[model samples]
Structures are given as C-alpha cells and as structure tokens.
Target: MFKVGDHVVYPYHGAGTIQDIEEKDILGEKLNYFVVFFPLNHVTLMLPENRVKTSGLRKIIQPKQIDELATALKPTESSTSKKDAARPYSKENETLLKSGDIMDAAMVISNLTSKEGERTNGLHMEDRKNLDRAKQFIVSELMLVNDLSEEEAYQFITDNSKGA
Candidate 1:
C-alpha cells in the first residue's frame, strides 16, 4: 500500500502523488480511498484501497532506471511497417500503458518514435492518439522523478532517443 505523498503511476493518467487517504461511507458501506493528485492534468482521483492491487497503481521508476529507459528506447525494430504501424501494431501501446511497467513504457516511446513519417501525418487516428498518450506517460514520470520541467523532460527524450 502507498502512503500519503508517495509518487505513483496511475496507468493511463500518468504520475501522481498520494495526497491523502480518506475513509468515507459510500453506498452505506465504509471504505478507504486514496486521494491522488495528477499534476499534469490538474485532476484528482480517488481509488478504493481494496482495489489498489488490481488498479494498476505502481511506484515511480528509480533514478537509475532513467538510464535503463534510455537504453530501452534505443530501438532496432518492433513495428512491422510504417504504413500499418498504428492501432494494432506494437500492441496498441495500451497493454504497455496499462502494465505500468517502466520498460514497457519505454518501448512505447521507442516504438512510436521509430515510426516513419513526421508526427501524426501518416498514422491512423488511434495510433496517433496512442503515441501522444505514451509520450504523456513518460513525460509525467520524468517531471517528478528528475525534478525537471515539462519541456526539459520532453527535450531529454527527444535528444536521447528517436522518433516521437
């Protein structure tokens, strides 16, 4: 279980801090929930304590792991072709985002970035959205963990890695 003020990744929502744990009566039953604040979107999320395990809540990557992520982003080949590289390609990037696995997240960044074409010009609509979401996940985590600004984290990724 995460304590208040702990940094955590909330799957598709990206990184957030546990602000508080509140116990309240809901539906006539008392349950505890974690109040998490997502800095990126300026939003708060309340998650049931009992559902934390299955909810994809995870601790942020360690500082050393940043280098590991960079290594993972150093890609060779994952997608089949540039034309069909969105949606079902690279597992939709949905599975990886849901896993909350840092390495998988890195692969999302790598795979999407490695796609041929500039930006969303040649990709399917869903694929473009997936790439944006994947970048958000990486950038959000980098902001808190590395004490870097949003632009810096993004630039870090662009400089150290390829593609997106």
Candidate 2:
C-alpha cells in the first residue's frame, strides 16, 4: 500500500502522488480511500483502499529504468506493414495502456510513433487520440521520475521517440 507523498501511476489517468488517505462513512459503513493528485492532468481521485491492487495502482518506475524506457521508444523493424501497424483504435494498444505498466505504455507509444513516422496522411482520428494518451502516460511518469518540467519531459519523450 502506498503512503502519502508516494508517486504512483493510475493506469490511463497518468501519474500522481498520494496526498492523503481518509476513512469515511457511507451507508453506515466505514471505508478507506486514497486521495491522489495528478499534477500533470490537473485532476484528483479518491480510490478505494480495497481496490488499489485490483485497480492497477502502482508505484512509478525507478530512475534507472528510464534508460530502458528510452530504448523502448527507439525505432525498430516490425513484421507488420505500416498500414496495418496499430490499426485504428487497436484493442491491443488499449490493453497496453490499461495495463498500468510503464514499459507496456512505452511499447504502445513506440509502435504508434513508428506508425506515424511511416504515414504521409498521419494517424487516423482514433490512432491520433491513442498516441496523445500514450504520450501523456510517458510524460507523467517521466516528470516524476526525473524531476523534469512538463515541457522538458515532453521533449525528452519526443526526442527519444525519434531515436535521436
């Protein structure tokens, strides 16, 4: 269980800190909840304490793992053709996003970035949205793990995604 001030990622919602844990009575039953503040997204959530494990609430990746994440963003050869790479609104990509694992998120971003690079018309509407969401996930964790500003984190991901 995470304590106050712990940095954690809440799946598709991106990363945040555990600001507080409160117990409240509802329907005459008391339950504990975790108050998480997502600075990147300007959002807060009160997740049930009992649901943290099942809810995919996990601590942020360690600083050393950043190198591995950068590697994941690097361009790579793939068996699938560009046109079929990460098909519009792909379920596989969606699952990766929902996994709440930083490496999984990196893989999704890498695949989509490669697809975007291969396209002249750009990603379809759904694909574009997925790319944005995947980027946010990476950006959020990057900011926390590296103590970087939002712009810097974004640029870091963009630069690494380009394999530069």
Candidate 3:
C-alpha cells in the first residue's frame, strides 16, 4: 500500500501523488480510499484501498530501471510481429499499457511508427493513440522521479532515441 506523498502511476491516467488516505462509511460499511492528485491536470482521484493491487497502482520505477527502459526504446525493429497476431492488436496494446513497463510501451510505439506514405488510415489512428499513451507514461514518470520538467524529460527521450 502507498502512503501520502508517494508517487504512483494509474494506468491510462498518467502519474499522480498520493495526497491522503481516508476512511468513510458507505452503505453501513467503512471503506478506505486513497486521494491522489494528478500533477499534470491538477485533478484528484479517489481510489479504493483494496483495489490498488488489482488496479495496477505502482510506485515509480527507479533510475536504473528507467535507464534500461530508455535503452529498450533505442531498438526499433521487432523480431516477431506475430507476437500480437493471436489477439486483436488493440487489445494487445491495452495489455501492454497496463503492464506499466515503459520499455514495453516504448517498443509498441517504436514498432508502430510509420514512414511517409506507409500508414493506412486505421493503422495511423492506432499508432497515434499508442504513441501518445507511451509518451505520457514515460514523460510523467521521468518528470516526477528525475525532478525534471515535462518538457525536459520529453526532449531527453527524443534526443536519446534520435539515432534509433
């Protein structure tokens, strides 16, 4: 369980700080919830305490882990495109996002990036959405953990991956 001031990432919601935990009576039952604040939007989210594990709430990755993830992003080609062929591609992408591994997320983005005139309408839409999700996840974690601004984190990633 996370305490107040802990940084966590909520899948698809970006990174947030746990502000407090409160217990309230609901339907004659006492339930606990964590109040988290999203730094990106100044929005607050109340997540049930018991659901943290199942909901994919996890502490930010350490610096070493981030470095590994950055390295993974530098490789663009996939050995087997069929890894995602058994299931629907969109569903596979959703599962990847939920994994909360920035490297896996970045792989999805890198694999889908298209060259000029190579993207179809459907593939282009999916690529854009997945890329945005990957960027948000990486940027938010980097900004919080490294004490860098979002813009700086973004630029760092872009610069590091420019040769990939």
Candidate 4:
C-alpha cells in the first residue's frame, strides 16, 4: 500500500500524490483507500488499497529510467504497413491505457508520433484523441520526476522522440 506523500499513477487518472489514506464505508463495506491529488488536472481521486495492482497504480519513474522510454520514442527503419490501421491502433492504445504501464505509455507516444510522420494526411480524429491522452500521461509522469512545466515536458518528449 502507498503511504501519504508518495507519488503514484492511476491507470485511468494519470499521475498524482497520495494526499491521505483512510478507511471509509462504501455500501457498508469498510475498506482502505488512497486519496490522490493530481496537479495537472487539479482533481482528487480515491482508490482502494486492495485494488492498487489491478488498477495499475504504482510509484513514478526515476529520471534515469526516462532513457529507456527515450529509446522507444526513437523511430525505426522498417515501415510495416497495416491492413486496417485504425482498428489495431485504437485497440493497442486502449490496452496501454488500461495497463497503465509507463513504458507502454511512452511507446504509444512514440508510435503515434512516428505514425504521424508516415501519414501524409495525418492521424484520424480517433488516433489524434488517443495520442493526446497518451502524451498527457507521459508528460504527467515526467512533470513529477523531472521538475518540468507542461510545455517543457511536451517539448522534451518531442525532442527525444524524433527518430535518429
């Protein structure tokens, strides 16, 4: 269980700090919960202690670990064509979102950014929306570990994400 003052990331809610932890009765079930406060959105979330793992809740990544994600942001040489690109793209993004894996989240940013390079017409509305969410998660995490403004985080991702 995460203690108060610890930074954590919730799959559905991005990253935040555990403002407090307390027990509350919900439907007569007295259980523990972590109260998280998101800086970016100014929103507070209360997540159950028991469901932490299933909810994809975990501590923030260190700055050094960002190097790993940076590699994922790099562009690949081969361009494999997709039969029905949007379908797979959407499904993959959804999986990552629900999984709340930081690396996979970074991969989404890299994949979507790189895919934009391949598409002359640019990403569809659906892909663009997903891209926005993916990028926000990355940026949110970066903001916590790296002491960066929102714009700075976005630029950092963009700069490192450009293929070598």
Off by over 4 Å in 3: 78-89, 114-123
lDDT (Cα, 0-100) at 121 in candidate 1: 62
Worst 10-residue stretch by lDDT in candidate 4? 79-88
lDDT of 4 by residue, 89-145 (tens): 877787887677778877777777777777777888778887888788888888998
- Candidate 1 local lDDT, 3-58, one digit each (tens): 99899998889998999999999999999999999898899999999999998899
Each candidate's root-mean-square deviation in Å? 2.8, 1.6, 3.6, 1.9
Give each model's whole-structure lDDT: 0.79, 0.86, 0.73, 0.81
Q: State the lDDT of candidate 3 residue by residue for 40-98, as single tens digits.
A: 76789999898898988889878777677667666354444333322235656667887
Name the TM-score of candidate 3: 0.82
What's the best-to-worst order under lDDT? Answer: 2, 4, 1, 3
Question: Which one is best on TM-score?
Answer: 2
Tell me the number of clashing residue pairs for each predicted model: 2, 0, 0, 0
Cα shift from native, residue 164, model 1 (Å): 14
What is the TM-score of each predicted model, taking all chains together? 0.86, 0.93, 0.82, 0.90
The C-alpha stretches of model 2 lying farther than 4 A from their native spots are 82-86
| Comparing 3 and 4 on lDDT, the stronger one | 4
Q: What lDDT tens digits, residue by residue, belong to model 2 across residues 42-149?
A: 999999898998999999999989899989988666567655754674677889899988888778778878777777878777777777888899899989999999
